[model samples]
Target: MVGVLAAAVAVLAVVTGLNLVLLFAVIRKLRTTEARLGTAPVATLPKQGSEIGSFLIAAEDDSMISDASIGDGMTVACVMPGCAPCKTQIAAFRERPRSAPEKTVFFVFGGQGEPETEELVTSLAGLGQVAVTQTAGAVGVALDDVTSFPTLLRTEGGRIAAVGRTWEDIGAVAVATVR
Candidate 1:
């Protein structure tokens, strides 16, 4: 009985050591990711009447933002794969009114070479235009300094009229900003 007890204690110790190593590894990875994301303070986001810089649409043929198929005004949605909140945001976008598609542009960041990215692009293609970019920072620089995921921007007459985090907010802004 004593020998069996000793064996069980040894096994428990080994398992505990393994878990500790894994926990430390995860912590290190999290810190590294945080550092890479930077600590820049979030700026006061653009509101109505803010003119935004143009961003390119990384299409099969590569087109400028000005040449997009949008009408009257445009809605730019920033998204990234592997983000849970972004999935919810996508669902909200999908539930938007049918007329919303024509004015919508989905900027897919970190989607290059991922199978899930391809699937998302394919799915959103029917709803609106999709631009698969390498990084969110690049898109932000082009679209009035956006730095976060799931950002929705509504533009009218080539200027930002509203910014939101959900589809409801965007729809409300669209209604109020009619030219």
Candidate 2:
């Protein structure tokens, strides 16, 4: 029994050592990748105050939604099926007081046959018009900076007022009231 216990301890120590070595290797690789990446974004978003890219999204009611149709200052939220923070972004829009339902738009980016697409579109019901599409839609082609899922942008006169990955960056309370 004592010999068996000793063997178990030795085995556990070996396993522990292997785990540590693997962990160190992972950490080293991560550091190297981070250094290589620096601060470059995969894609750039449209600059603030620039004319936003043109996009046409069909609402559930069959009405067409485009950058031109958003009344006055428009608040646009871009989210995807796999994005985790996207849920929080939706919650923020739902829980917080919004300015105008007509002026709000949520882009649910997903290809056909994506299971989570329905859930996202359904959750966005009544909050604003929901547009489920693949490949970032026309906005990506125009803005190029919408690579980050859950990006929130406020635009007026076909130009972007403010945009960011978080609500605070664009101002939750402040942005709610028209600029």
Candidate 3:
């Protein structure tokens, strides 16, 4: 009986040791897989260093906004109504100015006649030029990566210097202004 107990303990120890070894092997494989994928996240935001395509849009206030609108150090924030995160993102932007008001352009996505769309556009006017669109439509077709709401980015020389959901990720690169 004593021999049997000792053998059982030894078997369990070996099994545990083998499990640890396999765990380490799996972790190593996952790390390699991540590296193989180039560390590009599955986010909808455009990849940093990629150039944004040109566009000419009509702001809700009848202003003509173009690619030049975001020239140099402008920050572009795309948000949508009914998305809690979008509201939070904008609220944060309003509370803490990350870039110059003139350098920040907001694209609000929603149905053409939706009341919430108008409200969103109105609220963002204090920030800068605000555009209301029936959908991601043109912007989506142009920036393919801008399919998600609450995307914040700064472009420099037409290339995306930084892109993220929060200002902290892009704040430093944009034209600085306090509110």
Q: Which candidate leads the pack in lDDT?
A: 3
Reference-based lDDT, residue 178, model 2: 44
lDDT of 3 by residue, 1-179 (tens): 99999999999999999999999999999999999987876656778888777778898778888776678988888889887888897887777767777777888878777888878887787788788754657765454458777888888997788888888888643344543
Error of 3 at 135 (Å): 3.0
Q: Against the true structure, what is each candidate's TM-score?
A: 0.61, 0.68, 0.69
Q: 1-179 in candidate 1: lDDT tens per residue? A: 99999999999999999999999999999899889977765635546566666555665235545433433467778777776877887775555432355567787776577898877677676556677877645567766666567777777766777777776666633222232
For candidate 2, give the lDDT of residue 159.
Answer: 76
- Per-prediction CA RMSD (Å): 9.4, 9.0, 10.3
Error of 2 at 49 (Å): 1.6
Worst 10 residues of 1 by lDDT: 170-179
What is the C-alpha lDDT profile of model 2 across 37-155, one tens digit per residue?
A: 98664745557877776777787657888767754567788888878898987787777745467767877778755678887788888887777766646756554456777778777
lDDT of 1: 0.67
Q: Tell me the lDDT of model 3 at 47.
A: 81
**Cα lDDT, all candidates:** 0.67, 0.74, 0.78
Candidate 3's TM-score: 0.69
Best by TM-score: 3
- List the candidates ranked by TM-score, beginning with the highest: 3, 2, 1
